[model samples]
Target chain A: MAASSTGLRYPSNKKTIYDRNINRTKTSELSRAAFAYLFVEMITYAQRRVTGIADLEKRLNTQGYPLGLRLLDLLLARTASSATTSPANLRPTRILPLLQFIHTTLWRHLFGRPADALERSAANAAEYMISDNDPLVNGYVSVPKEISQLNCAAFVAGVIEGVCEGAGFATDGVSAHWAEGAGGGEDMWPGKTIFLIRFREEVMEREEILGRAG
Target chain B: MRREWEGEKLPRVVFTLLIVSKAGGLIYNREFHAGLSKQDTNELLIIAGTFHGVHAISQKLCPVPPAQPPPSNIPTMPVRPSGIEVMESANFRLQCFQTVTGTKFLLFTEPQQPNIDGIMRRIYELYCDFAMKNPFYTVEMPIRCEKFDRGLDGFVKATR
Candidate 1:
């Protein structure tokens, strides 16, 4: 209840993050160059004393995880704040709706556009893929040939992982993979990235139980 | 009016921008215009270190303002010395803009160039966006970002 050292006094009533208005300000654009520079610095910092490319990616993913968690609430709050919508209606209960939320709403909020495609894994029922022809985060990045397997989009994958976990959908792991020229050479997006999201077996079991009840 | 006319006659060019960290390290050094001859990397580092020392000493040399009795109406913030801001030479002018966090931006420009303050502001804005916000940028380290370079180039060129 006491005032903090910075002289910021919050009322005795504790205000939660959700209590604040999310849409107080209209949509604003940030400089992409700044983001790229910061991302480059992040990569450089992560690369320091790292054993391999995988370790660097893990660091990037960890950095993005918190952002994803925060964004999930903010994005949903924005949708729920609109006059016509209720919070109940906005809550994504099913896997399909959750994926749709990420594919359309989350992508649009972060990248200014919807994902290129959302697909179910042909080989695995537990997996889903979100494709971005050219992820904005990777726009200014060029991975070295020696670390050819490394994709900076792992940060985005971490965000996806955060969103899934925050939404009560337990996931085993989320990974980013380069799928360049998958849609043929004619496609404009050459740096195509596919984020493979795999749900845990417990989540699948819960979904099956809920399916029968619904 | 006279200054504006003179400014128009002489080309407005930003020769270079050097960023010195709080710890007296040269974190970023970039040259925009090709006019100035490049200095050795060691020389640049020495320059940064010397400037940092001078800047700190200059702050100490500043005379303390006379204290006034607390007023009921207005809140007063503590005053800190703003060290050497500008250095002028025969051919070029050097302007220094220091941030609240002690990062210094030194811009070398044409002697007659106008609105150096505005240029400094934009640069700071770009730094905040690209460098500070970047999750990967650690404090007090060299910045080697293609985007930051490209953006700085575009901004400077567009202004010209």
Candidate 2:
């Protein structure tokens, strides 16, 4: 094979992924079915040769990690290019903006609807929760009867971790948990998923300094 | 267009569908009408592979070269001529549309069916939503999305 100056080989079409614009299409919507099938496959792949539920969930999360990293750059470029909404040249320097960006912009992009709620943890200052009622992925997947503890949305959590890491916000870990009947919620909306995002000590410390600066 | 004052029916049937991956592997196959004779899965896979090869050769066999556009600063998508789009026989017809990403949709329909291209485009749309966007779908692998099946069922029913 003939090699280019850079190691990346262009396709027969003579176009590289770099030649294409990532943020070109905005109005197109993804079918929930696509996400559902993908989620099921991810679970199936992770379930193979697995020790326990936690290990399976961890594998699913790891699978989605790189997707989040790529989306972080793509989405930031999208927001910066589209000037109609709030200022175009915004990169999330602080924790609040980044969280808000994920809660609103990223959620809407992925799920077509904004997250149900975003709340700070009462007990842990570093922990934040973003909840979605009847997540699109969960809507179509009926978890098998055997492993009831598995939350397929852990893949989404992995994506959030990638975004946070890409955006320079280090986190202790991000995870997905079923918030069924917790905190006096989801009585009307069952299968509510709460994404628990916990920032590292350094992140909270930096937030402290940033808050003082403002 | 025929007058629809009777409120009877519109189009005909989509007998079957075969999806070939960019690499020419048979990724999906489904039968809609019960009457159409079925081919063995192995036979279908070979047909798909054969068609992929023929499609590639057909592009090279084009008698005339496409005229180059005036030089421009912006890079453009390569405008290669498409391969065999429609094949007609005394009994049924085969309609094919290949996506830019190289995934091919082969739709078999009744010979008299109209507006097959529109239906092909719609099928492509469904594939984009259900197959391409799927995170677990390794590119060029078999597509097994329940939503895609449901969507197709609904679409075919409504079309009929």
Best by lDDT: 1
The lDDT of each candidate is 0.83, 0.80
Q: Give residue B37's lDDT in candidate 2 (0 to 100).
A: 81
lDDT of 2 by residue, B14-80 (tens): 8998999999999999888864687999999998999999988887787465487756887777657
TM-score of chain A of 1: 0.86
Ten residues in sequence with the least summed lDDT for candidate 2 chain B: B2-11
lDDT of 1 at B50: 95
Per-model root-mean-square deviation over C-alphas: 7.1, 10.6
Residue A198, model 1, lDDT: 99
Quote the lDDT for B157 in model 2: 68
Instruction: Find the 10 residues in a row with the least total lDDT in model 2 chain A.
Output: A1-10
Fraction of real interface contacts that model 2 preserves: 0.06
DockQ values of all predictions: 0.10, 0.06
Off by over 4 Å in 1: A1-11, A14-51, A56-98, A108-113, A116-129, A132-156, A159-172, A177-194, A198-214, B1-9, B64-77
